[model samples]
Target: MILQGNDPTTGASFTLGNRLQRQLWQCVWLCLFRPSPRPLHAWRAALLRLFGARLGPHVHIYPGVKIWAPWQLSVGGHSGVADGVTLYNMAPIEIGAYCVVSQGAHLCTGSHDYNSANFQLVAHPIVLASHVWICAEAFVSPGVSLAEGAVVAPRSVVTRSLRTPWTVYAGIPARPISTRTRHGTAPD
Candidate 1:
């Protein structure tokens, strides 16, 4: 939740409970989640589920991935979040079925309002529709939603929502480069 009147620069942006939970999660992540073998996707998924994350069957979340809050994350069936991906979900982040988030991709749901004198904390949810693919090193900004079958090219930055399904986006501020042809089996 965005702290409407709180000054992020001087005061705490999140509740005490929230801060404690994150600290505990960090310990677990360092000890249990980070050192696991790469093939142990199910093990990591179980750890995430234990923290209240809603993950569907066969979702492969690599051990190297960093999730700010697992409880605020949800991944649909057969989706894969590759190694080095950072899910900074201050708010909820939802990844639809059959999606792929490649290595080094960052999905951020929190930011500070630059215009505010106190640097107010702000947050919004990020949504990746079914069959969406975020290529390696892509940066998805807060509140951005990618349509079904939308693909973000490697190293691209997405500041706005990608409304066109089956489209491929590229460049710094990602723009539609080509319309992709969708072909994929339904997640069981």
Candidate 2:
């Protein structure tokens, strides 16, 4: 897919670069002022929007939710990014409608190339499908996908893809813990 907010070929553009700088400024504001919960949350979301975050309707992002670059983050309708969640999105991060990113969760979207002489950087996108629940303290590494209706339990570290719908995933380098309906009932 064409990664939103980035030129797939050149991977760089003046507009995108300027937006990235603006996002960093917003992060600085968040770190310095430490505004109250409600207003802070709203302001931060607004800042993200200003920098090209294509958030659909009713996206709630709490204060203490850190985003590396707004240009790299997109949230679909009715999504919730909870407090203390950090999105290290040096690359694109796409969240589908109704996704819930719980408190303290981390979505890391970039890494350094250890073999490179200058330790060059590399980035990959993280995609979360509709109705996914990333539980509190969970981490999603770069290039991972959490498919629709997938529930990642608290403290889980997801390194691989979770493609099946309505599956529960837990533990470090998260694995499927169980499978159930969206309402939590096991399928017959």
Candidate 3:
């Protein structure tokens, strides 16, 4: 589905330019210096901001995080998007306050339209609500939403809507593993 609020031409340009810039920066950093935990965060954030990323207060973006378009990323206050996380957002990617996108998680907000002869591109928005945790190696596909406090376990492939709050989702094409408190306690 064509996502609303994204102009096709503008989105294309943004995607292309942002990808090139990110790649250049990545190469430079990797070649020149090793990925150190210290100083990289500030440096990366500056680069992202230069590319028009709408980052809110105290957002901690670790090294090795790949963002397709900084202009397409909208991170709310105090969010932590960890290392090796890839945000392939051809459209908008909105991460709400205090969300934790753990290491190696992929948030893909764009895909190719297979039905068309030319293989037209299609993009969608990904929304993650406050306090959500996308665990390591989890994949959140186009247009998916992780409700507030939802937890996606490691290596889970989330291919559908996750509307339940404070629930644990696990496995490939993730299903609700259980409904429980944030600490994994059974609900009373």
Candidate with top TM-score is 1
| Error at 35, model 3, angstroms | 4.9
Top-down TM-score ranking: 1, 2, 3
Ranking by lDDT: 1, 2, 3
lDDT of each: 0.93, 0.80, 0.79
Each candidate's root-mean-square deviation in Å?
A: 1.3, 6.0, 5.6
Instruction: Give TM per candidate.
Output: 0.96, 0.80, 0.78
Query: Which TM-score value belongs to model 1?
Result: 0.96
lDDT against true structure, model 1:
0.93
The digit string of per-residue lDDT tens for model 3 on 1-188 reads 24333545545424554567767756755753236565566666766787778887778887667777677899987888887899888789999888889999999988867766545677779999878889999999998988888899999999888999988999988999887567642222
The alpha-carbon deviation from the true structure for residue 124 of candidate 3, after best TM-score superposition, in angstroms, is 0.5
RMSD of 1: 1.3
| Candidate 1 stretches greater than 4 Å from native | 185-188
Q: In angstroms, how far off is 89's CA in candidate 1?
A: 0.2
Model 1, position 108, has a per-residue lDDT of 98
Instruction: Give the distance in Å from residue 164's predicted Cα in candidate 2 to where it truly belongs.
Output: 1.2
Q: Score residue 74 of candidate 3 by CA lDDT.
A: 92
